[model samples]
Target: MGSNPAAPIEVHDLTVAYRKKPVLWDIDFELPEGRLIGLVGPNGAGKSTLIKAIMGLMPLLSGYVRVYGQPLEDRRELVGYVPQRESVDWDFPVDALDVVTMGRYGRMGLFTRPSKEDYEIAMACLDKVGMADYAKRQISQLSGGQQQRVFLARALTQDASIYLMDEPFAGVDAATEKAIIELLKELKSKQKTVLVVHHDLNTAEEYFDWLMLLNMRLVKFGETRDVFTQENLRMTYGGKLHLLSEAAEKVARQ
Candidate 1:
């Protein structure tokens, strides 16, 4: 199939498996550019897995992902990723500014080190996320909300056209959540696409303009008001797929 230039993200026949068990199956969807999208699903519903596959971090069992009508590898510079906070080793002895500087590494190349201007850019991004004062503080010393802000700062430094974030609001305080929502709005205003893996059903409608509901498959994907209905929520969260749930549980245990 031909790629859609207008869509910032497109997944065709995407499937991911672990040890012969499928996590996401036959996933297909295209996200419009410049919108805040929420990937909402239950635990083990392959939210993180889908983002990983799109980023080319995980081996796809089958199918393809395209960003701006190009393969992910070809479009790496155009995409920024904010991984789950738990995925990182916070105690690794890196300060907040150092962590944000890592975002510029992609643009800096393998041999060149971050220059003084790069540090300025990183600090500017930290200030955007309201974490400039703690730039020199160790990442481990920051609270959960503070750590999340730092990660966002790093993504901002990438200056990408599309951003994929995993559970950004999880464990954050109300103020942090509000700040993130505002940042997302700013990105949208600038015509950037953002796909966030979100867990809270209560605020999903309020936070995102679009929604992609997944349950080991594509249940629905569209505008929030149209797809974020009672019936869709039941299909996503309600216990309708016992076998899939069992497989997901097994994979989680591994």
Candidate 2:
């Protein structure tokens, strides 16, 4: 394997399965540092599965993932993950600030609590996402877009070099979407790499500098202008292997 020290994320022959059925097969790609990347594919395309595998949240059937030329476990602190907003329990009794402060928990050992400085850092993140005023509001009280911004703020507080966000634009207002794109640009300017799981093909070209096209595997990964063409998108969303389709369907049914 060519280990480029500058690449933020490197996957080699990665495979993941649910039960006995494969979800992602023989996936391999390296994400360049300091770019805003859009990971696009049709539903059930294993986009989120890929992010989950990278975060070690899901078991991998085979293959390995590296972060900054080292095993993922060794550089876990350098990776920040923003899961889908829907995956969270909104009703839990926590304000926006509390949620953001939780990001510091990884840096803070189990026995230590967040200090005043940590709270300041969380507030700064909230301000960066334009949610500083909502710090005291209950998470459930925020609008969909505001909730998403809060999540972004939480991820920002991690101060990670690389970020993996799953569908950050889903269910967000246009204003929130624009804000997120700006935040991504800011991250890129700071030499941080961000990979966003995005579904809207129309906005995909406009938002990202790099693109990762996946359909149960890596279809193409390169600069947006080169990889986001009609042919590659067709290959991603079009005809699938009957057996793989059937397996995915069966897994979904369960």
Q: Looking at model 1, which ten-residue stretch has the lowest summed lDDT?
A: 243-252
Q: Write the per-residue lDDT of candidate 1 for residues 129-179, one digit (tens) a residue.
A: 899999999999999999999999999999999999999998898778888
**Each model's C-alpha lDDT?**
0.90, 0.90
TM-score between model 2 and native: 0.92
Which ranges in model 2 have alpha carbons more than 4 Å from their true place? 239-254
lDDT of 1 at 11: 92
Q: Which segments of model 1 are wrong by more than 4 Å?
A: 1-3, 239-254
* Model 2 residue 24 lDDT score: 100
RMSD of each: 4.9, 5.2
lDDT (10s digit) by residue, model 2, range 1-254: 26686579998899999999999999988888788999998889899999999999999999999998899989988999999999989999999999999998989877999999999999999999999999999999999999999999999999999999999998888789889989998999999999999977777898999999998989999999999776777788765556435644664454
Candidate 2 residue pairs in clash (backbone atoms < 3 Å): none
